[model samples]
Target: MRQLRRLVLMAVCSTLVVASPTRSLAREGVTQQVHEARQEGSVWTAFAFNRHLSPFSLNVDVEGSVATLTGTVENEVKRELAEQVALGIDGIETVDNRIRVDPGVRPRLVSVAAVDERLDDATVEARVKSKLLWNTRTEGLDIGVESREGLVTLSGESASAQARELAGKLAASTEGVERVDNAIRVTGEPGTVARAQSEVAQAGNLLGDAWITGRVKTRFLSSDNLGALDISVRTDEGVVHLAGTVATAAEKELAVETARNVRGVLDVQAASLKVAG
Candidate 1:
């Protein structure tokens, strides 16, 4: 009886040992399938975006169940359509679309050196300003314009949100603008006290953003180290968004510091500023 009991215990132990490994192996297989499914979803998303948005440069990166779409597309429709295609993929859990719209430029194959060889910044700025001035909606507004590497930045104060949006559209639709960062603030709401916070006042200080923008632009023009025309500066309620390219790293640093030192500038953001190689 003792031998029989020992034999039964041993048999049970062996069964458990064998079944445990089998279960672990099955789980690993499932995990691998999930990973492969995510990869497949990313590839399919890319194909769909490319098929639909052939004229735009779009890239997809997938991790686990999340898909991130990056690169530049032409216009808003293409940008939205790329996001939709990524979301439609079966295994994707989320889609982070960071694709920007290049209204004046189309997708092309070129080297970084070639990018630096494109249209001059001064010409691009003039074209953008002309377009904005011709547009009846944005005409007569003191919109501070700056261009760098075909990207235009419009800084000033608009009468309303609609006018601000219209100014951005005009800049983007210009002949030389590859992208536009419309930092024009809408007046009549509140005065920009801090970078993000604004306090309500008695129907006064409506042109606060415009004042800051003009001051910053004047400082840039006066500075010997910074090329005001090569850099685009936009002041949105005292927060300065600098876009465009500079000659060197030193110039970039000077530009940011200059913007920060401005009397009314609350903060300086240079994420859009790219240095020429």
Candidate 2:
């Protein structure tokens, strides 16, 4: 009986040893599948958020670090754009772009539930943040901006109540923003705003004139108070020239002030920015 018990114990140990490796292999396979699924999802989300690529029906497949794109676009430029966007995703080392460029292909109608409209939210957040950064009064304040749909929420610490109010105004002035929820706290800390401003100024000095011009244009485009397409922005050295037709004297004045506050702008020449009749 003792010998029989010993044999049974040995058999049990052998079974466990064999099952352990099989279980490990199964777990590894599942992990790999999950990783691939995540990669596919990331690629899909990137395509969905891009305005240029969103309208077209695109498909993404991922294996390991390689992403395969299959879709039909109107032109070759869009096909290349799809590939580049896929390459931008993290962990994607290679993109096999199998997209066909058929000039006759039309964009499919996407259902609202199928795609979350976070692109507009993202644009609103960026515009609000840029406005705050370009505004002299609120540029130095620690302001956190968040947007959901058209509603914007501001949170952070401010050195003064005026700064907090200014931050909210800047956010509200951004185009596409429907409401502003100002949650900024006033600390009344001396030199806090000044110190932050100094740091921002130092960083701004390193930016190129072209970069400054582009930023100014982007700000104008997102501003509710300005007509971006009507305005011409040109930066020379550190000076900005504005030649455009605005609705009122107040708008022209606002335009000048807006350009002047942008970092790296030494001066704004807006004599030619005439008010419309």
Candidate 3:
């Protein structure tokens, strides 16, 4: 019985999952027909997104090769990480971010309030503390005020946007504040919005500049002994390798010429082309 259980467990564990549709866009095919078939427009993305994801409350949506993600996450870093994984797919064009942030998400900014003690010493500390404490918005601000001569300096991390923005105003308005140096860092999390934009920009470069225009179409094309299925183009440096299908022997020759003439191309490998009657 023990031996049988062990064998069954091994059998179940050894099963390798293959052909998951989620990342299939990474598969290689150079022909126009192949690209058209493999290019998942919208439906495949929408159906596949929720199939696997983190258990967090953030919501992600997909439509027509564009993915839109929403909902709130506990931490800012998790929000950015999730977006990175989704954009790794080849076919994705855009990502719309509508995700809300948690309370902790507002702390990306830091504020340092400093004062020159040469103005007023004794009441300056009390006065700064009173001002900070009185402001309802700065409750989460970790404050430190120091006085030399007569100036009061304040420093702390603001809790939210309003807090960081108002730190200078709040400090300068205080009674004993003579010169306020507000060093609050306003850093919004590099969440989906920032990352998605960067990825789209990168993809634009890839689509625009690769040496091989990929199974390109030509005005007057020809070939020789080229198989229509051998559309794979391998490039040795700047030289293009043509593989796959062709309609006639003329097409094989035409393809090699077409590849040779493409801008920045060095040469062509038309060996894989097969022409038929």
Candidate 4:
């Protein structure tokens, strides 16, 4: 009887030991499946938001850190674009692009909701407004900006004809703006300069030196005339310092004007900026 009882207890212990690891492994497998699903969802959402890849109904599959893309695009360029976008996502170490390049494959008509379209337009409008507010030439002017499908419309009042034209130029130069319809009326307002000064005074207290410097550098980077030029910008207490090499004297002058136009710039010291040989 004693031997039989000991044998039964040993069998039960052996069964429990084997079952524990099996249960643990089952849990681990589930966790891995969930992680891969989330990664796949992330890649799918990214493709949906991307302008170039959104039109195509691309399928994404993720395994561990690799994402596999399969779809049909109009050309090879778009197929490559899709791969690049997938690789851009975090945790996606590699992209296996199996997209077919069929010239006959037209982009599917992906119907974007009206709300999404409006959101895009709102983003463009905000960008234009920010550009105007940051620019010294257009800041403090009563300008209204609206955007729809990359078309920008400008209205309100300007103090001078030059201001009105500058507003238009700034809007046209913006990234999403396809065309600008400038309807700003020149009111010959006397307080334009004063209002500008007052706005700057208020901004001076809030705008840090680093913020001013960054804006100045960004302006240089975006300017077609200055983007290629090597320019260095620094700011201290609303005063900006510019240093770099420019090909021509006119370029140097334009650089100075650009720096001066940034809001919160109390003065510009450009003596260090020199013309190239």
Candidate 5:
């Protein structure tokens, strides 16, 4: 009778353990802990004291592994910098930066600091160069930086269009930078001629469609929000097809929206992009 009772008790305990859903609870607890820790760290307060980010009015919202930045910054460079800073923090998976640009603030800021003389062109140039060298994004590229007065220019060959854009951003984010002129050219792949021939033959008489496709690609390449590195675009008549993997659902949505908004795009067909793991 005792053996029978012991067997029943063991079965009951096993059933209870199987039904507990402990894994889900553990995941939720970890996420909550990380969220609380980030809040305690005072991320926004740190932003205000950062040299590159200090000029902006910043607000930070931490949700799960994503950090969304909202507020106004003096320029596009500051806006990008705000996102970069948020992304640098631990446990952040994505940065949704929506910082408004107020270009008018630049002249007023320059005038306010006029009492302490401006950073010399050489000093500004050196600073920009050092930042570019240190930045992992543009460091590997053999780009050149030059500054005159307050305007900075970047010229050289980059491996990809993203590299060119990153180089420009690095220069613009420097303390004394007024403006950046990015003239960096993207080097073509070894099979460029064959690829161009294949494309021309495949789309023989659809010259207008080809032009529209080129325009869409250029727009994607130019945007700070969208990275066209892995995205491939094609056009047929007025219909555009987009295929590629993106970092998140947000990036996929932005790419499709951008393609659809183009002047000559009548329809956009985008396959479900695989989100990064």
Candidate 6:
């Protein structure tokens, strides 16, 4: 009976360990703790005190200690100061610095701040929309550009998924883009999502690409290092190339299918792709 009882206890322990969702719980707990530790009021006080920053020109929006700082500053230096102050506080979890700079500091910003510093609101919107329509990837054009203030808001439908995401990122990163409101949706083609999803992901991924191989492991399917892997993307010339060694033939087809969905892709070249694994 003693030995039997020990076996039963061991089985119960194993079951409990398996059933409990500890991995997910631990991640959530850590995120929550970070939020709790970073309180808003404390960050605000820090923002107010920093010599390089001033609360008078800053706006703070806080939720459960997470802070988003948005407003206008005179120049790039002041804009950075605002972020530094908010994050310097020990308990603050996050800081979003969305501040606009004066045109005097940078001519491009003078043409892009959301508030009209130069032209009428209607005129600004028209000009921005016209630009989007001209771009191949920005087919579904919904643009709101306040020329007087030079703040641009873009929304609409694109023929391809890659277009929608690239248009937004391009606008956001533009020299004249003071504030980019990306409302573009991915629709219009069969394989649209696949092509655009990867590129959109790459926009952020390329910044710190070394981190990806550690996280999203490559599952190769073929003998050739390049084959068996799936890669489909629209080139600058508007051609789609499907390359990679896959572990199986099914993966090769799936990769091709993924490329076919992108809007404005001339054609998917799958001859270069192979499957092995």
Clashes of 1: 0
Cα displacement (angstroms), candidate 4, residue 52, comes to 0.9
Winner on lDDT (1 vs 4): 4
Each prediction's whole-model lDDT (CA): 0.59, 0.68, 0.44, 0.68, 0.60, 0.45
Better of 3 and 5 by TM-score: 5
- Candidate 2 vs candidate 6: which has greater lDDT? 2
* C-alpha lDDT of residue 243 in model 5: 83
Model 4 TM-score on a 0 to 1 scale: 0.35
Write candidate 5's Cα lDDT for 158-271 as tens digits: 777776776787678776788899998999432111112221122222223534555566567667877435787777767899887888888888888998997658789987
In model 4, what lDDT does residue 129 have?
63
Instruction: Please write out the lDDT profile of model 2 over residues 2-64, one tens digit for every residue.
Output: 345446545643554587886345435434544554455556656765668888988877778
Q: Residue pairs in steric clash, candidate 2? A: none
**RMSD per prediction, one decimal?**
24.3, 23.3, 25.3, 25.2, 22.5, 25.7
Off by over 4 Å in 2: 1-19, 109-114, 117-277
Tens digits of per-residue lDDT, candidate 1, 1-277, equal 4345446545644664587886345434433433433343334324432445644545566556777888887788878888777777667778888988878866665432332232144335544554444334554466877777777889998877877887787678666579988999888432221110011110012223433554565567566676335776666656889999887888888889988987657789998998888
For model 6, give the 10-residue run with minimal summed lDDT: 209-218
Off by over 4 Å in 6: 1-38, 103-277
Score every model by TM-score: 0.28, 0.36, 0.24, 0.35, 0.28, 0.24
lDDT of 4 by residue, 36-149 (tens): 544554465556656677788687777788899998888888899888888876788999999999889877655445324544554455456655664455665768777889
Ten-residue region with minimum lDDT total, candidate 2: 198-207
Model 6's TM-score against the true structure: 0.24
